[model samples]
Target: MRLVTYRRSIEAEARLGVLVDDLVIDVATLGERAGSPLPSRMLDFIKLGPVAVSELGFLLKEAGGRWPVNGALPLAGVILLAPIPRPDKNVFGIGLNYIDHVAESAAALDTAPDLPKQPVIFSKPPTSVIAPGEPIVHRADITQQLDWEVELAAIIGTTAQRVTRENALSHVFGYTVLIDMSARDCRRAGQWIYSKGQDSYCPMGPCIVTADEIPDPQTLDLWLTVNGVEKQRNNTSHMLFKVDELIADISQGITLEPGDIIATGTPEGVGAGRNPQEWVWPGDVIEAEATGIGKLRHPVVAG
Candidate 1:
């Protein structure tokens, strides 16, 4: 099941729905039709625990056999929000997890690409999130050296602390594509927060695919593109640290709660590493895609 949070208009409240064949079936409407309305928000649904998964499982099973489409809405008619817009906590991030990305970043800095013995943790505030199709504000004055990072975001299904790598996957709800849109100015000033936490800096979610669907998160292929030109092409398999390790590492002292988001580090090929640099310009379309999850496309607009 590809779960989504959406709305009819800018003023409308976010609603939960399941995406099927480019259409969205409001879970509330589906529940009403089934005489049992499911949770109405993405976080609420995820918090429902296995019940939500079971509900989605039933829906997917029914659809596979022959969908009982009664109140489905065309996907084109609604606004897609980050699966959990206004996330309860800041988004946890890992920097330079991919070997090649580490190498490239080091090269750009004219330093050795020594791998981090541990994950390089960072965070992006909730305000950074923007929905797919929304424009990524190109802060020309603040940073013409804007960049893009296509990543696979893990949606936590339940609270986890001191979890072992072996059981890490059990806590995963699913995955979605997140483009870690960046501004380079503040990063050079050693202020990653301002560089990454700007409004509309994180473009996420076409929809969240259940963890059950992705057998091995590390096997997934993900990439980023500028307009129609493919620049980053790498697989999760290339990461020096895999998903399970990240989960266990992150949850060691900090508790990961349901609805929390963790974006695994991005792979090689970013604007900063390019020979002459390929910063974003207004009107450029950026796209992030992962094999099983989905694609996230947004245009850059002058801010």
Candidate 2:
């Protein structure tokens, strides 16, 4: 099932719903009719886990036929919000996880930094998150070389620690699209915090598909286009360290709680990798998509 969060109006609070075809079924409305417990918000539904998810699926199936019955509101009238608007913690991101991306960065930096014998991990602040269709603030004054990195993000379903690669995927809730917006200028200064943590830099979700929907995570085709021009194109099969290894590696000591997101990194063809280099400016539109998962589009505006 595809789960979503949306707001009917600016003054309204975010609500939980299920996305079926082009319609959005308000879980609360269905729960009320089905005699199941109603969750106050999207986060509440997430906290309820698989049982709640199953109950929702059953309710929707029972509702049968068409959705958003007459007199009921249509999903088109509501503003689709990020599946998880504000994640509970930082978003884990892997760096240099694709061979081509690694090679490109190595040549661009010309600094041949240690080849991260293991997964090179970093994180983006939770405040940076913006939902699909939202505007990405282009901090013109702070950065002239704003760029984009399209990545595949995995959502954790349950708390986990010291997990083995053999069972790492069992801890995953699902997958979604993550745009790792970056400020190349800030990154050259030393740390990734300023480069990657700018407000509205991280754009994720339209919805979260349960792990079952994607039987194999390794074969998805991921791509990104800027102003209708393709920039990055690659398959998840090229990931230097696959999802299972990544989960096991990250969870070795630290605890991964439900709702925590881990961005599996981008492929080659970033703006910085171009001959003369290309960068995002105010008014530029970015669209990133992954197979099975969905698409995320955001416009660039002055910060």
Candidate 3:
């Protein structure tokens, strides 16, 4: 099921729903119809865990296929929110996962800078998250070189610790599109945190696709376009360290709690790679998509 958090109107509170085709079946409404009351907020449902998902599935099945066609719920009238709008912790993102990206970044680094033998991980503050179609603040003064990175983000479903690769995927909730917006200048100034933690830098979601739907996570096609012009294009198969390894590696010492998101890095074609580089400016729009997941488009605006 493609689960979403949306508001019917700008002033209305956000509600959780499951999107089927063009229609959205409000989960709360369905629960009410079934003589039960569910928390209207997506965060509440997320906290409810597998029980909530199973209950929702039962409700949909009990509807006997009449619920979605009722036209009482209109998807076009709603405003979408980030699937898990305020994750419990900072988003963990891997840098240079794709071979091409690794090569490009290596070349850009000051000669033979002792790269981390393990995954170079960093965190993006939760405040950075914005929904698909939200505006990405382009801080022109703070950052002259703003770049886009289209990455596949894995959503953790349950708490995991010392999980082996064989059992790693079982802990995954699903996948979604993540645009790791970067400020090249700040990233070069010092550590990655400052550049990566800027507000509205991480734009995620159209909806979260349950892991069952995607049989193979590593085979998906991922791409990004800036104002209708294609930029980053590659497959998840190109990842230097696969999803399972990433999870196991990251969780070795640190515990990965529920709702933690891990962005599995981007492929080549970043603006900084171009001979005459191109950076995002005010009024620019970026659209990023991953197979089976969906699209995330955000407009860039001067801060």
For every candidate in turn, the CA RMSD to the true structure comes to: 2.0, 1.9, 2.1
Using TM-score as the measure, which candidate wins?
Answer: 2
Tens digit of lDDT per residue, candidate 1, span 187-297? 854547788879999899989998888979989889788879999999999988899999999999899999999999999899988898788889899988999778888
Work out the TM-score per prediction. 0.94, 0.94, 0.93
lDDT of 2 by residue, 1-303 (tens): 887788878898888877777777777877776677678576677667777767777777887844544213566787878788988899998888898888788777453445567898889998999988999998778999999999999988877799999999988888888999988888754568788988999999888888888867999999999999999999999999999999999999788888889999999999987888899999999999999888999999997
Q: Which regions of candidate 3 fall more than 4 Å away from where they truly are?
A: 68-72, 109-116, 188-190
Q: What is the lDDT of residue 34 in candidate 2?
A: 65
Model 3, residue 288: displacement in angstroms? 0.5
Q: What is the lDDT for 38 in model 3?
A: 74
Q: Give per-residue CA lDDT, model 3, range 128-210, as digits (tens).
A: 99987999998777999888999999988877899998888888877889999888888754578888889999999999887
Each model's C-alpha lDDT? 0.86, 0.85, 0.85
TM-score ranking of the models = 2, 1, 3
Candidate 3 TM-score versus the reference: 0.93
lDDT of 3: 0.85
Each candidate's number of clashing pairs is 0, 0, 0
Residue 245 of model 3 has an lDDT of 92
Clashing pairs in 2: none
* Superior candidate under lDDT, 1 versus 3: 1
Off by over 4 Å in 1: 59-70, 110-112
lDDT of 1: 0.86
